[model samples]
Target chain A: MVFGADRECEFLSAPRPSTQETFSGQPLACLEVLGRTMVERTVQQFFQADVEFVTLLAPVALSHSLPSFRERNRALKVKLANDMPLAIGRTLNEYSRNGIDNCFVVSGNLYAETDLLDFFFFHREAMRPVSRAVDHDGPLDMWVVDTAKAMRFDGDQFSKDVNSYLIGGYVRRLDHPADLRGLINDALVGRCAMRPSGREAKPGIWIDSGAGIDRRARIVSPAYIGRGSRVHEDALITRSSSIERNCRIDCGTVIEDSSILANTSVGIWLDLRHAIACGDKLFSLAHGVAVEISDPSLLQPMANVVHAAPARGNLEVIEIEEENLFPLSTQEEAPARPKWQLGANLIQG
Target chain B: MRESSPVIVMEVPTILNDVEGQAFLQETQPLLEGGRPCLVLDCSHLQRVDSAGIEVLLHCMEDAMKRDGDVKLAAVSPACAALLELMRVDRVFEIFQTAQEAVQSFHTPAAIDAPVTLPWYSHPGGLDALKAAS
Candidate 1:
């Protein structure tokens, strides 16, 4: 279960700007990387290692977390919990109630591709209270422990400073969006165990099966656009960017070395470089600036974006081919810009 | 791509805001100084254009019209076109899909779609366009 506050949203700005009333607090766990969340990725690692009966805990309501994430394996379970204390308490209580001996405690906020089976067996054989994976940074907080014995029955506090076993493959504690940036670069360079969607459009670029890309758009090397995303005309996605599922890239925007989270719609005529866009909120991971875009015409949430018909003709196919042909279109015309409200700043960030 | 036909072609950068628009006017002032004012503004690379870009285009268009010539936009991106259309300036310029097509429009004067009915409240010389431009 993912129960840690080391990298939780404690000191960040208000999750929503005042202008938006319908904004829900979407956790970073739902921020899809290569079409998979950190939780989903961690769960997949366990499933791949032939580990059965896994349980997950998250901060958000189960509705927001479980819709798109009906896992491949049936043995996985999910629960709603707020922080590490509650999550740990719930996990141990449930395990104890079920008479389960040892359970794997995986943090939803962390992503590692270690030999999970080996780690479990290592913990089983070590005859210790817990056996956690330790990377160069420190303990990854993912370990196998006798839930009833190690955790307090009252379920309030447990010591995190435990001895760890170094069984490192590709471990990373996603403490910040900046940390995700390194993991993205690692995944792009083929260092990590994550997989891209569909076929590789080129050696480095990966476009999933159902992405919409305008013919006028230019995608440079080492980019990944997930399924059901739309890239509009004259848009430029270059230099190691990742756009997750069902996201929309409006006209004239340039995204370079950025990560656009799922179900988010990026606005027109903007430049995004070395950043992370979660929903309508933009965070310049490079500049440490976070701004909420209230204009729906600009950046907004569209969970139903995948259901809409994508742009057609040349952009119909997920053409991963490196072709920059500007095919002439008679239908081309300058559409109107969104009416700017009196004092609403065009580029807030 | 510079095309030195009877209709001179001037390339526009992707971003054409106030500063860049002013710089563009300065760079092209020499061409408009003494020669025939016929010009084709290539906007193939122009992904964005603000009100200042619109002002420059209209000013150059008026200057060309004063000299009995015209300015046409060629290969304007969807984004540039959208902003122009939103401000109702799309009707003011003779637009083409390609630079070659825009150049060819100079030979056939009947093909030009000059702005006949602009919104009376908004004129390039007036404060509305100026306010909108900023």
Candidate 2:
């Protein structure tokens, strides 16, 4: 059996950018990839490796807010730090005080699938104060450090003489939107360990729970329809594209090699190719430009939809505004009526 | 030999939405009606464009082709150029840096098929160079 149970190893995750500002130059790690956040996946990795505890260092602004992804480890703690380096240094000093010899210090802004137990054992065998992960590209921010020696760590950067552990597994630096798309495509094609969290309806096609895909909707292979998403009639999703949670792909809209992020509603009969859409903002990957469409009919945030609530007593005749009855959205909240409700309304009207 | 029609340069509006697109189409309708019409849409003032605006551009191009004529774009802003590229309409029109160059293109038969030189940012190494400098 693996020798990680008795070991008092811990994990310290540095502060990561909030996914809400993803298009505004934040790291892609916090953004929901496939069905889970990278932080959740990283925590799960530590939990699976029998790591004792995992602590997440969050920025002061994002201290109160946590991502929606579920963490497998209940021992995961969130600590606020105005300064990352000072926080990391203080945390390392505290760990040393607690008799915790060494801990895994992983960067929050990356998704790496290196064997944690192997890395731990390698660090011990190397007899170095610090061991950093390096791949074919270059050195990563991932490290295993001696808690005492790393007490005075220079922010997140390691000294030039630190030991290097060559990682033979997958690692993705979430620096750019193109890297995000590349990671998604790589995960879908089985180049990495990160798999879509859902049932594979067919070969190369993943459909998450509660996804309402019309029978007429054509979902070509190697595409993902995330949780609670909807794909309307004649909508074509092809070429390694992903319609993330709570998004609505309208009728006859062809999405090829693109990502329709959570809670977005695309207009009908439009062709979205090589793009990433979040609400009304569409970023073209091919052209390297982002535009915000002002027309609600063309594209709008799903949460911006105003619902007609039922009125009590006296029965005041409130006029109901016309809603776009076009089929499907890709996420959770169906505030007023589902697509079937629209069909019922159509019949009644 | 017949003398060619003079190139008509139409100024595009600031915001190219449905209303602006219809007005633009109406303004260029007379030019498209003429035989062998050479049109250049100057987009220096363009800031925003919707899908309908792109549709108007296509409609003008179709009308021009029907009358044995052509439509070219000139002085397209980066934002407009990006949108056109997104809609895959960049390949349909011949784009020029300035309206004068677009106007001169009509008279120069040899320069009609010349490829437009791409901006530095369009090159793969260009982004790396930019990043290095920054």
Candidate 3:
């Protein structure tokens, strides 16, 4: 089971970017590690360890707020971790009652590049109350817990034990904003176990299969462009930058050392550097400021095609006022009349 | 589709660049000028259309109108739809999902058995239908 805390980062002293601000309305688990979410990669780890099925425990708010999480978990036989606090005791009790003893509990916000099968086997031999993933720094909040022993104590036991044998290896806890940058950089450098979306066009650069970059677009690699994303003409993608799925970089935009989240639109002629652009809000790492861009030409939301398939080759882009597509009020409605009404009027005529 | 004797369905080329667009205009000019007032441009195969292509389509629409004829588009691909919308010329012409439907529309303005029951304006002929003569 994966545990997710929507807790504010203890690191950011003031003006802490909320979880929604940090992840474009997604929970921490939904943050892309390379191209995959932390939850998906964690589940992949469980399967690699030969552990079948999972119970993901997340805050109920997170469960409802993130539709993508629901989509990611839709395929697997894993049980939904509906409530964050109540689920731990309930899961342990259910396991104990069902005579299911050994189960792994992993934190959802981290990706550890360790051999999970080896760790699980070690935990099985040691037969401790719980054996967690640990390095010299301390416990990484990933562990194998025996349900019978877990049932004997409160939910706090999962957090209490650090004496569990150290499986000295690498782990990325994506709590701080800088740590997130580290994860992307690590993924780019081949230090992490994850893979980027596209074929390796050149060394240290990865582009997704469904994404597109115009011939005039300049990409100095050691970077990644996620699936379904588009880099328009004369756009510059350089210096370890990552642009996530379905995002559109308009013409003449320069992106340097930034992470543009999925479904965002970078308007034409803007310069985004050392920042994280999520939705309309851009958080600058250089100045430690987050500002919301209200200009549609500067930045917009790809609400319709955000979750769609890869970018189609040679598809023409329609440049219409977005309000024409979705009008909130009666007066500003689209000029295109409904077909039925048109037919009725035509027949009457 | 209707069994209308005078209505002719014409298929537009897939790629309507400048050359193809000009050719399309030349090919359709005779039919439009021959007192054939109702024409359907079947766009099921039309994958791409540029500014020149839209210009030619508009020209045919203009000629058809002078002869009391109308040019309707059918089965427009998303790429072509976007092109038309980008040019803000989508409202100028009648559009349908299938050539059969567009042809049948010439007979009865109301599509009785069509699956998509969206309300539409069949003819502007470059002006509002109610404000102008049919």
Candidate 4:
């Protein structure tokens, strides 16, 4: 009996004016994408789907001031209250008074694409509590309740104008800042689908299924490599790029169109175009400015440890400052010319 | 200030403030601090810029290079030249393509006209000169 969805959920109960008072007035209680804390990447995608006994309905003043959300959900089970549909209806009425009949209502800023969690456990074992995973505009990002049809769902029968159901993650209650860029471009373009493989596979690419890549990492097809992302040796991931989840694009970072959102750690001669890095800030979406790179060897935070250090000590300090200043074969080299000069006088005659 | 006078436009809007960056640096800081050498910056109703509107165009290019004046950026809006080449400061400004050729490069006189000899020469076997002109 594994139940989830409670990474200390307050999931923005709209008072507005707070994403640090509309972007960086400074007091962020969490919502950082590529450096953890979108409620710790939705509790590390529910502990990489091994989801056993999780509860977390948060807000007893953020479960007593988040000590790494109380030491990684120590054998989970939290139920603080104060409205989140009455704390997820009193934690689904205490998991339906312990008789726990199917439940997995996810969304702590939803980001689970674990191969769409086996198509949400095969549409919750073929429509159990009338399952869901719908997207391509049919909303519903994960839902598998059968607490006897959620005790006939009367928490105001959830309706933010429901057109095709399953609404958690405060459905569009992401308040402002253009609803957090339309909830991160509608969860990277699968439009609320529980996990239709985190959409985007072209026009600004976003591949995520088992994520590998390194037939010599060039990856330039628009670019975004989420779910289990990796791209070692010769990395380049060009224009309008994204590279989220379990990231690591070392060996020559050039990630252009830039977003690098989930669990980032890109090093090696980094170029990062357009930019948004997220967690430890670094935003510059063409200079809207944010920069707080607190050095983890310059832009760290993939929970640290990413060792690839050695451009042979920066090419031996540029070949010992070019052999103490231009000692290239006793430097006299300005001779081999002839690039293009036949009939060259075009105007200054 | 007479580049055959007619190009000192200035609408500037795609949202930039600080009273529109101090009213576009007080109406182009006195014709770019008097040398008035070539100043367009129209930006067909801009759309956004802040860092005090790119520090008033880097303070009108440092008050037009301390008065020898030279701030020619015209009609730029691809989101204001991608926020000035992502703040690499668009290679320190000077990008003209109109505003009457940036006020005719301040009164056109750097060696007036001399290069236009083209009576005709497009024949790298242009279909054998269009089959000997059909």
All DockQ scores: 0.02, 0.20, 0.01, 0.01
Each model's fnat? 0.00, 0.21, 0.00, 0.00
lDDT of each: 0.62, 0.73, 0.63, 0.50
Could you say which candidate leads in lDDT? 2
After superposition, the stretches of candidate 1 with alpha carbons farther than 4 Å from their true spots are: A1-24, A60-67, A82-87, A97-99, A153-157, A303-349, B1-134
Q: What are the per-residue Cα lDDT tens digits for candidate 1 across A157-270?
A: 233544477855777666566767778777877888776654575677776646667666777767887766778877788877888877899888888888888778887776
Ten contiguous residues with the weakest lDDT in model 1 chain A = A6-15
Q: Please, what is the TM-score per model?
A: 0.57, 0.77, 0.57, 0.29
Q: How close to the true structure is residue B26 of candidate 3, measured as C-alpha lDDT?
A: 84
lDDT of 2 by residue, A1-349 (tens): 2454333556545445654335633345555678776776787788888777777765554433334443223566656666667777877888888877778888766788878888888888899889989999998878888898887668544645688999988889876777778888999888998888776767778877667777667888788888778888888888889988778998888899998876789878777888888788888787677777776766777873222223322212222223322222233335434453222221100
| Candidate 4 local lDDT, B25-110, one digit each (tens) | 88777676554445678766766665568778888778767755567677766545654554446778766655666666756644
Relative to the unseen true structure, what is the C-alpha lDDT of residue A112 in candidate 2, on a scale of 0 to 100? 86
True contacts kept of 2: 0.21
The docking quality of candidate 2, as DockQ, is 0.20
Q: Which segments of candidate 4 are over 4 A away from where they belong?
A: A1-36, A39-41, A44-70, A74-130, A133-138, A145-169, A172-349, B1-35, B39-60, B63-65, B68-70, B75-134
Better model by lDDT: candidate 1 vs candidate 2: 2
Candidate 4 chain A, which ten residues in sequence have the lowest lDDT sum?
A313-322
> A218-281 in candidate 4: lDDT tens per residue?
7665445665566766768765366766677776666676666556676665566666564444
